[model samples]
Target: MTKNETDERRAAMALLAAATARELDSAWTAWPERPAVEDLRKAACGLVMVRGRIGGDGAPFNLGEATVTRAAVRLSTGHIGHAYLLGRAPERARLAAIFDALWQDVSARPRVDTELLAPVRARLAAEAAKAVAEAAATRVEFFTVTRGDNQEAAS
Candidate 1:
């Protein structure tokens, strides 16, 4: 895949991974047609070593371990999709993988975006905006007025 394809795939996968199980299942239920999907890798849960960098620029270190579930699916059209998500929601992982493969098809991409990605993107955007607004509402500005005597002394 080209760089753009890789980027788009990455973004689609992230959006899928962010989706709640109910949302994903609903999207699957709304599919106009079901393409045969083969499980390249069955959904499984495991632990991964979480790593972090101090201030995002310092040396990397192991933060902790997190539970992650992963799955891979191959569509009839030959596209393969993979997913790794936090927590043990195997069904969600499988659905996400299936959607990922579906999203690979240029013709199916628009439908996938509308049925799954677009709504999720809008909801997430609104949520983020609400959070920002809430934080902004609590913002405080600090300022000082110079004393007349101090101004005179400086002059």
Candidate 2:
């Protein structure tokens, strides 16, 4: 995908995750019997990088590794949906992957949005808000004045 399209998709995913979190929280509050997504039995594994670090100005360091958390969901229709997240939280990733697969179904997108997107979006929104607040605490403002500014202002 183009850069803009990729960015747009990321934005959508963020919203979907936040919305889903809210729904999940509400469901847990209103219905004690409803299984939380995380309560569902699931397995998680990591996607790792095999290579080491590269040359730099300081002493040589090993890039070592990074991992993506992955989970698998088996649907009633016999399709298996796999999700890989940048970090741990395999259950959520699995649910999201299942929803993504279902979103491919022409008739299932709306249901997926209602059932999955709403809750996730709420969680993501909370996360994003926290990040923004943290970042805002460290914000720095910078300005520059050009030589031409004096010439232009004199006119």
Candidate 3:
């Protein structure tokens, strides 16, 4: 595949992996049955160190650890898929992997995109917007008053 296509596919897979279990379950219920998927690697959970930079460009530091689950599957047609998700939702990881594999199939791509990924994407976007609005509602703006001496006033 071309670079752009590869990037797009990667982005789609990332979205699938990041989806919540409820979102995935809803999309899965709407999807049609397909060929059986063989587990290339069963879902497993582990801890990974979360890292951060001082100012996003400074030295990196360990923020903490986070639980992560990962799974791999191969469709009957030989397309392979994998997913890594936060927390211990094994089933969610597996389902995400399956969708990733389905997305690679040309015949299934359109259906998977429209039926599965699109709705989840929309829901996620709406939730994010709602969260942003809620946060904005609670926002407190601060202002500083200058002294007559052209110096900043201590508040």
Candidate 4:
């Protein structure tokens, strides 16, 4: 896949991670007909070593281990998709993998992008904006004044 495809898939996965159970269920329900999906790798939870850097480009180090659930699904049409969710949400990981496979299809991309991703994107954006506004509301600014000889003499 090209860089664009990789980026698009990454963004789709990110949005899928934020999708609610209701949203995923609704997406599945709304489909006119469901394709046969095979679990190449059933949803399973495991620990993965988290890596971090002193700075973004600094040397990498193992931060710690995090619980991650991952799954892989293959559409009847032969498209394979995989997902790794942050927590042990089997249902979410399974649904996300299925959606990832669906998004790969040219015909199904529109529906997946609209019905699932759009709502999640909107919700996340709203949440981020609210957080920024809340933080701004409580924001403080500090400044230091320089004392001059004249001020000292006056005192």
Better of 1 and 2 by TM-score: 1
Candidate 3 local lDDT, residue 101 = 89
TM-score of each: 0.89, 0.46, 0.83, 0.87
Local error of candidate 1 at 72, Å?
0.6
lDDT of each: 0.93, 0.53, 0.88, 0.89
Q: Which is superior by TM-score, 2 or 4?
A: 4
Off by over 4 Å in 1: 145-155
- Top model number, lDDT: 1
lDDT of 1 by residue, 70-111 (tens): 999998889888998999999999999999988988889999
RMSD to native for every prediction? 2.4, 8.2, 4.2, 3.1
For residues 7-124, write the lDDT of model 4, one tens digit per residue.
9999999888778778888898888688999999999999999999978779999999999889999999888988888888888889999999999998999999889999899989
Give the lDDT of residue 45 in candidate 1: 98
TM-score of 4: 0.87
Candidate 3 per-residue lDDT, tens place, 1-155, comes to 89998998988987897788887777777777777889999999999999999999899999999999999999998999899888998999999998898888999999888877887788889999999999999999888765777554544
CA lDDT for candidate 2: 0.53
Candidate 2 regions off by >4 Å? Answer: 1-44, 50-62, 72-74, 78-80, 87-90, 140-155
Candidate numbers sorted by lDDT from highest down: 1, 4, 3, 2
- In terms of lDDT, the poorest run of 10 residues in model 2 is 32-41
